[model samples]
Target: MAARGGGGMTASTRLAYQYVVLRCVPRVDREEFLNVGVVVYCQSADYLEVAWEVDRDRLAALDPGLDLDQVCEALTFVEGVCAGDERGGAAGAKPPGQRFGFLKAPRSTVLQPGPVHGGVTTDPARQLDHLLSKLVT
Candidate 1:
């Protein structure tokens, strides 16, 4: 079957399963972009890891003086998402790193947030909803 990410498949069936993706940041020429890690991993193991590719191109476009390795490291959370392999908490928690990125790691475990990144962990709680509403839509 054709891969979702559209490339060589990962060596895991867990990746082949059907997964949902919530894309953010519309693409340049295409439709939209997948910036969140949890959504990317939960979608499929492969996706050719399109987000990584998108990120690479974006970093180059941004010209932020970032190296390829650094770019990959920043996306490590994606891998962690796969490892966690749990139903993303819904209704409440924090930003869902599953699709969104950036989370304050806890001492006992890596805290998983709800669907929308950047919350109290980021700015004053009041502004989080406003920012996410604009960003997600």
Candidate 2:
């Protein structure tokens, strides 16, 4: 459901939204992690977006020996997965929902998606920005 807001803006419909945090673990054995990015998807709106912030200072705090290059590459991959672009490879050919599912799947890697969280939103794009701001950055 939606309502008209002030300024003649129509409130967005209550649509389902899913999101996950991207974590980077320098050493998986010790299990310490840093939230580097976020992925958001709204099936109803056919929207999938990825937003990330990789602060070298924070990464170094996690592991002084951490490879900044590798981390950036991993972040790029996440963005590609969300974009479903040619860079995404085979996964890019899939639909928006499938791309989201692939990104959210559990995997042991430098860049891993945390648990998926659900919520309601009027605008998926706006919601993506909101979640990325609150959760990732």
Candidate 3:
């Protein structure tokens, strides 16, 4: 269900990645609708990188064996989900009935260019710092 990442991969890679994450990852954030997937990660430099999200309930219901390539597959799925949200579609796409119960809906991904203007450092460690400064500026 999960596949590892070290090379180029596409959307089809998610199932493999999900399997790996389900096997190794013990705890994941479970407070929101976000809990449906697994959040597998590894340490890199400083910031916590979200490697992938596995379907939590489904994975628990069924066991997926270790397949080396599966890890990269799931990461692709997470990438898809992130890309989908960034289009400004998912937030406004919510059903009308669901909107009534929640006072405020979570913000969808809006990736405007930062005040470092067109330059976001290639370094992931600088992401938080760049974003924080942009927010205040």
Tens digits of per-residue lDDT for model 3 on 1-137? 22233233333332111111112222223211222222221122211222333444444444344332453453443433322333224532333222211212222221111111122233432332343333322
**Candidate scoring better on TM-score of 2 and 3:** 2
Off by over 4 Å in 3: 1-23, 26-65, 85-125, 128-137
Ranking of all candidate structures by their TM-score, best first = 2, 1, 3
Best by lDDT: 2
12-128 in candidate 2: lDDT tens per residue?
567788999989988898898988888878777667888788888988998999998999887777677677777678897899889998999998887888999999888776776
TM-score of 1: 0.28
Model 2 pairs whose backbones collide? none
Q: Which stretches of candidate 2 lie over 4 Å from their true place?
A: 1-10
Model 1 clashing residue pairs (backbone): 5-47, 36-99, 38-98, 39-98, 94-114, 96-114
Better of 1 and 2 by lDDT: 2
Tens digits of per-residue lDDT for model 1 on 1-137? 11233233433332222222233232234433443322322222222121222345654454444354643443454433433323223311333333323332322211122343321111121132343344332
Every candidate's lDDT: 0.31, 0.79, 0.28
Candidate 3 lDDT for residue 33? 23
